[model samples]
Target: MSESSGEKTEQPTQKKLDDARKKGQVAKSQDLVSAALLVGSMGIVFLLTGNFIGGQIVGLTQKSIQQAATFRGELDMATAGDVLLEGLTTLALTLAPLFLVVFILAALVGYIQVGALFSTEALKPDMNRLNPFTAFQQKFFKSRTYIEFAKTILKLVIATGIASYTILGSRHMLPSLARVSPAETSQFILAQIVELGLAVAICFVALGALDFFLQKFLHIQDLKMTKQEVKEEWKEQEGDPHIKAERRALHMELLNEASAQAVRESDVVLVNPTHVAVALRYDRKTMQAPQITAKGADLIAAQIRKVAQEAGVPIKRDVALARALYELEVNSEIPENLYEAIAIVLRWAYTVAETHPRS
Candidate 1:
């Protein structure tokens, strides 16, 4: 039976929390590696597609210009629609392979983390999971909901503030750009792109900081354990107290039965007064040495002696040998040191049995 934890289980100490976090933080290395590879491959595909798109756009523009010059007029509207359709078709074609690769990569990541034991049980509809009360408790009572809400609000405020600041900073540029030449316009556009990128980088840093804190919080929360829970788990794993006692009782009963069976068949039942008893048997073809068919103590010892007398099996009084046999041997063979003594006892018993043959 398992030992119980005290009535009040204290929350995990800092040390315990650290240990739990260490155990839980066994990151899936293969999944992460595969994810990196997948992202790199997808990035390459997108880069190639972007180049193709740029070339197609540049080529189309040049062709339109040539057509306009040849016709001695502006390009026809119908041809523009054809150009748009061709660009869209090319975009779709470029994206198809990338999408397929992404889908397979995501599946690989999941497989690496959890293996291929896909359970339809998880997919089956659960009414309890969708219940309003369950949802409310999960969202409010659970710490996860609070953390998610805080992160969402933080992201919104930071992103909006940065975007507003950047837009305000660019107000004068817009009016100036409206009055600029093509060369000046290109310079202004380049400056705007740099400004926008810096603002995005600041927002990204804030997001990363939030992610680190959120993960730490979740790790700590999961490590917290109640005493009652530990005790219950221990009992379930090691066995219930009552169940263990019952099993021990049954085991002793079986041992007694085995002892009785051994006594009836044994050539000799050796006893050390009331404390220990060992029944031994020797069959020339079946065993090279005497085998301890069964052994017992106290009341079981008395039973073994009684059964031996009823079966006409010989009984020998060897206190030291009996104790040694009972202590050393289990359900099998006699000790090697006791072989000479056991052989002498067996020879005497067989001689007596042969002299007084069974009626």
Candidate 2:
């Protein structure tokens, strides 16, 4: 069956996954980034700027009041402009650290989830997104819409539970707030606010992790292929001409090496004097007949002759014996029909080996 017509039963191929990634299709949960940013920004505010912000606000209030008090009349445009510029400048300077925290945390969270991915494919406009029918089906007819709804419910329940518990714990301090000094009251309120923020942030992290895993699972499922697709991909890869050529070259190289080694180990190389060469080895202790260790023609025969000369193995020129032995494969024993002829050649080689006895 065609891949598109069949059910997706095979896991996704690496090529398919890589193509999806290049098109900016990835499993990502925005909730995870949001949760991390919320936690980071909250920590920066409470730890570094909790008192600094209040002090800056009070200073800006004093500056505005002084500007009005000095000119004791309806505010002139120039004076108001000066005060406004100062307020804006103060606000920017005061929140610079908070903005930096958010920027850094968001980038870090996104990188941890997707590594280093920069694709503009997602930014390209598509006409399919404009189709109302498609949009409607995606919103109301897809499983993802229900999944989002479930996530929302989970967040709401966790947040409400945290809020309720926090309120009950701080109930006894509510009435005493009026009697306490303003500074102490502010401190108490700040502590309660910090507690709530921390609890909410922690819950968000838990929910975000669950959401991330769910999205990753769905993404893989969506990319799964059918069996036909796997077969087609395999065929295309195996049939590539370049790959086949490489395989052939490697096979030839291995064969040439084996042929050269056999020539060096042969008991004697029987040659046709110029063109054909056949190397034979026999062990009366182990073999009943002589074995053809190597054979070659033309350039390879020259190579085998060269290896035989270097290894001190004797070379004999015999047209009939070399021609007949060359027809057999290397490593095969000579047929019984040729044993008498081979025995004469081997007997002469042994006599030469014993007489010339080189160290």
Candidate 3:
């Protein structure tokens, strides 16, 4: 039974594809490194900006506290609310533009690493992807995903623990902070900021490194090709051997058919038996010399002669001319060197055939 249209056809396997799957194409490590640098730079900018903003806020709050104690004026809650509102409004106006600039810079830096081409094909839903078995196979069965999940958990635990430690450590310094002079307090805050920043930076750097490796592993896994897909690609690119042989055979058959047609329509067949055959046609008004219509050897030569006999076309038995024409003038004008000789033979034959007028 013939295969249905929708059924998949088998094709030749390519070793190149197998090799590619085993050693997947390498991702640009430079891009990932650039991305990491951009992320770390953004973190540094956020840390510096946040610290500066917090220091300004604390200074304003402290001034308000001092004014409340020293001034003999009535404690107006409405005035306090107005001052607080103005402070918040000023902060919002100043920091909104700064945050916008930082965000745009960070986005541009990330784009420089990953490029700007947004591939929406990756977002398209696939029925195969929704299968529970396939999902399970990818998440748990795949070593890459299993490792990524573990790394993610480790990163979360480490970052949270480090951040918690920094906050707790700040509490230890807070009690003595009230007793110190303003200059000393400021110096101690600066020291604490540096310590916390260093801790956060170190923790995130380790997590980023793990994320980078996990990303690389996932990319390589995704690029892997199945055996069947590799075979189909080979068939599409480099044709199947069996199909190629069949096409070659069909091409030869068509050539034979064309040769047969030329033979049957020819005016005369000149032959050196199986070795040579040349079919010639001449029209006195249309052509200055006889044109060779077809030529071939062995079985084809015999077929040409047989067709010429059935069509009542002349058969000249000149071994030298037949062999020469077959070798040099197959489907072309007869050579200038042999034209005079051929004219003489044709004139003589015409005379003989005209006088006899065979019944």
Candidate 4:
């Protein structure tokens, strides 16, 4: 038995999911994409800084400052514009690779989560969204809202702890930085930044994974169908069974009526003793071969025999021919393979007719 109207017991069908997707409803996590972008950007930064890229940036900075210093005495609109352009070009060169890496990673993460999807249905305005009461219920009354709140709090606490721990661990090394050479101090700072960034990225990824699963769970829950909805959908897809059964009953009634009429007009009735009966008719000027005028089994076979007897049609007991014709439809021509067998039955019927003519 199906569940009650209020109970959502059925999983969403493929058609249901496809319709939802067309309306821009899909399982995805913004947090996962954010995490991937952050991690990817940080990794790019770390790799660039560890290589000659970092030295190139330092050299560019020094050269810019030297140019600015040289222009101090003769600074003009033209000289300022040139200096600005040089600085902007250097900045673009420094950040372009990191930006590309982050963009690619974000796009890949989005694809993996939801595939390719574009729908304008989500952009359409709904008056329900303007209702304060409905908005309040969605935000506060929903269980998912509470789960999201808990996740936010947990992420804040974890991020704070990680940052605090990293700062405290580096506190001892901070004082020694002033005692070390300038190059050593710079390397130490860069190393600490990398360490902190890596730790934070790992935390984001862990939270993102949990959020992705939570999003999928909520998506499936939202798609569950009630019993009534399932029935309506099934009817739309496969048609109503009650209507189909009625049509079948009408078809059988018409077929039986036609068989009864054929039995009355048959030339000969062939019987499988008691189980089967077939009535055949042949007209030399009309029909090229003998055709079964009626066929039936069991109770219907009894009816065929009675109709044949009342019409004064000749009846012959031939089990093989009777069974074979019983398998054919009314008014169907007998197969060539059964020609000899049916010919024998016709001869016997003709002999009987001559011996006892009908009044």
Instruction: Tell me each candidate's TM-score.
Output: 0.40, 0.65, 0.40, 0.63
lDDT (C-alpha, whole model) for all candidates: 0.65, 0.84, 0.64, 0.83
Model 1 lDDT tens row, 98-199: 667666765665455435443355566889897999988887898767866876687577667876887888887788877789857865664555555455
- Rank the models by TM-score, top first: 2, 4, 1, 3
In model 3, the number of clashes is: 0
Q: Please, what's the RMSD in Å of model 2? A: 15.5
CA lDDT for candidate 1: 0.65
Query: In model 2, what is the error at residue 36, expressed in angstroms?
Result: 0.9
Cα lDDT of model 4 overall? Answer: 0.83
TM-score of 3: 0.40
Could you say which candidate leads in TM-score?
A: 2
Q: Ten residues in a row with the worst lDDT in model 1?
A: 26-35
Candidate 3 local lDDT, 143-185, one digit each (tens): 7666756766875686578767877877877899889899788
Runs off by more than 4 Å, candidate 1: 1-55, 58-85, 93-122, 181-198, 219-223, 239-359
Model 3: lDDT equals: 0.64
Q: Please list the residue runs of candidate 4 whose C-alpha ends up more than 4 Å from where it truly belongs after superposition.
A: 1-5, 181-183, 239-359
